[model samples]
Target: MAHALIRRTLHAAAAAVVAATGLVAAGATTATPARAAVTCGVLFDDFSYASASDPALAQRGWHIRTSAGGPGVPGATWSAGNVSFPTVDGQTVARLQATTNGTGAGTTHAEMSLPDRRFFEGTYFARIKFADTPVSGNDGDLVNQTFYTISPLRYAMDPIYSELDFSEYLPNGGWGATGPTNFQTTWYTYQPDPWVQDRQYSSQSRSIAGWRDVMATVSGGEVRYYIDGQLVGTHGGKFYPRQNMSIDFNQWFIDLTGHSGGTSVWHENVDYVFHAKKQVLTPAQATARVNAFRAAGTRHTDNVTADNSCTPAETPPPAGGTTRIASNWNNKCIDVPNWNFADRQRVHVWDCTDGTNQKWQFVDGTVRTENNKCLDVADAATHDGAAVQIYTCNGTAAQQFVLSAAGDLVNPQAGKCVDIAEWNPDNGAVLHLWTCVGGANQKWRRA
Candidate 1:
């Protein structure tokens, strides 16, 4: 996710405290430990590819972004040409090069992403070499070298959108700041046009000029960020990721303000990346795993699968009993707007009343209204923000829902929850299918 830089002086102090505590050396080499038993799925890649276009790369779910977009200098093309796999410091590494000639059209950014959005609640570790100065240009330019995970933002200030930026290293800072700052930001949601953001970030305003271990452990509802084995920040609450996200790495210019004269080129190098699904590993343990993989001559491994074994089964409500399903956010009932009985009419939250339109019964695996229309995922769509509407009762998975013990009303087909759009607390706010982030807007109860 793109972010406007905001200074947090407290984080600088926190970095100093961490440095004094001797948690771990910044660039120390980790010793290869004995092979450990793998209790869960894991992915480790050492970037041993011939080039960005290598067939093996695509087969392994890697994509070299060739799209044109924002999150960088406006009009700057994200070019596959800028991504390369080369030998650096005696090891094959994925290298991203971004160049600019002090003009939007003359700039090119590099990004590589995994197509799957199945990563959630895991330990993410990477060894990256950050450059404070351009590899072949005049000294100053505002560049962001990043490694992050993000789910699509369906709408402005989407309540269930998830992003965890493990690291965004700005060698020459942008967004109204000075040079050489690094940030670890956890996102809740944001608006792009007016630029309003709801997030928590920790930054260190010193040079992160060389290879460093950047790690994040997501567990027990908190995201803990570590650099070189020292704890840098811990963010939780609303910022906790509510869904799976793609793993990505990119190098781009925040803007051209710091760009000077002739074309300048910058580079970010990634030696390896590791992820342990549903497991929280310490920085030391993560590094040890990386080392062990290398020692065993395993250049890449991915045993991670989309495991939904924990999904709760549908439990029907009491026989012949009907109740009002109210949102935990505002105590408003799930209502068919205007008492509309037409099929495919979207549902919304409204003040609870004795109206039959607001009354619901859990029968079979579906939540049905007093009028017999079932709450369904529109057109059986599985994407985020799919409409939650009333449709003629049918035994499709789209109409099946499980009210999990945690209060989430989940559509088993989409694996999403019925969410009050945009976190709006007012009556008549529309509801839609969104990632189950356990947010108040996704929680419901029988009232």
Candidate 2:
């Protein structure tokens, strides 16, 4: 759950578009060309846990919330006790229960999340059962049942903040809205106090009272959301996630306003979840994959690995601190051939010199020369041996590089190291991409 205030303002333009065009009709699907199979990572969990304390759950990187938190009724307790595994409809399911007695302190929220913020640009799928009425008490609490992914907010309006709300089902409605509305929101960033937010959402108003397939596909800068194989919304631009995020499912009370007196208990159930890293799968294709896994008796599987070894810098280097990027193999500085600053000029290593082309400044994930040309991967290629050159900075992933503490300059998108081609040590040795093997030719440092 992000914040209560964050969902208050829906983008007017998005709302207008939804009103005019309407959501893609149920069972509507787009045909896409078949792609050749590529080696990709994946994660799937049937969530057949014995209890909230199941060691297998923790081993699989799941954390049940026991800490107190916001994004719910203030002072509400978030407890591990609220998360349980039970047999429902002959299937083991993860269940989250939220209860309230008309007071903040008397409310308890439930949440389960993965600790690793490594999911990005993938197809996420979950089968969830959302309840519109409490099992034991009166209904009408402003409860939120959600399946979302989020990265930490380093600061107010952090440009790298990423979050995608696949579904936020409001059975009774909060933030001054009517009941039984489901929202799919894509977030850019937000501020807590004084309440500011940048987000886009599409909503459908109706009773979604049972098990439903909720999926979101992230690729090519856009996030397409589908419910039961029906396209519900598509959002992109700044709202597209810029960093990795943790997958989460939570149920919390928006406020205690709907509570009458007695304790009201609401439940959200999750049958399973799946993620295909860096792959764009349609809802039908994703469902087929899930079925195949189950048919093969696969309980759980996880092969998703970190995209790169380098941790990105939180802030750019100090101003006026440009330095020569010297290759450890020959102590030669990365240089622009013959002082040419033209786009697509191949960058090479030259003897340590006083040339401005050899002086590079680290700025917002890009290495820039004195002539304002960026060190970029030619053709935006991610394959091995892709050429390295100087190009106009366009803020694409090809222009992003992170110099690691271990001295490897890595293109995170390509998961490759900047290497002196073929371990060449002579002046004018060209640069290219290669698997990070920690070789001398792949190591660089500021000189």
Candidate 2 lDDT, tens digit per residue, 176-247?
567788999899988767677888888888888899999999988899999999999999998999877778
Please report the TM-score between candidate 1 and the true structure: 0.62
Please write out the lDDT profile of model 1 over residues 1-447, one tens digit for every residue. 244653221111121111111011012133532111112346788999998879999888887877666677778888899999989999999999999999999999988877566577878999999999888978798889999887777677889878888999988876655868898999898777676788988988889989999999998899999999999999999899987777889888878888879999999999999887776777877776676567536688664444423332333344446989998878999999889979999999999999989889875446888767789888999777899999987546677676766788877566567889999998889999876666789889888
User: Alpha carbon lDDT of residue 30, candidate 1?
Assistant: 38
- In candidate 1, what residue range of length 10 has the lowest lDDT sum? 19-28
Global CA lDDT computed for model 1: 0.77
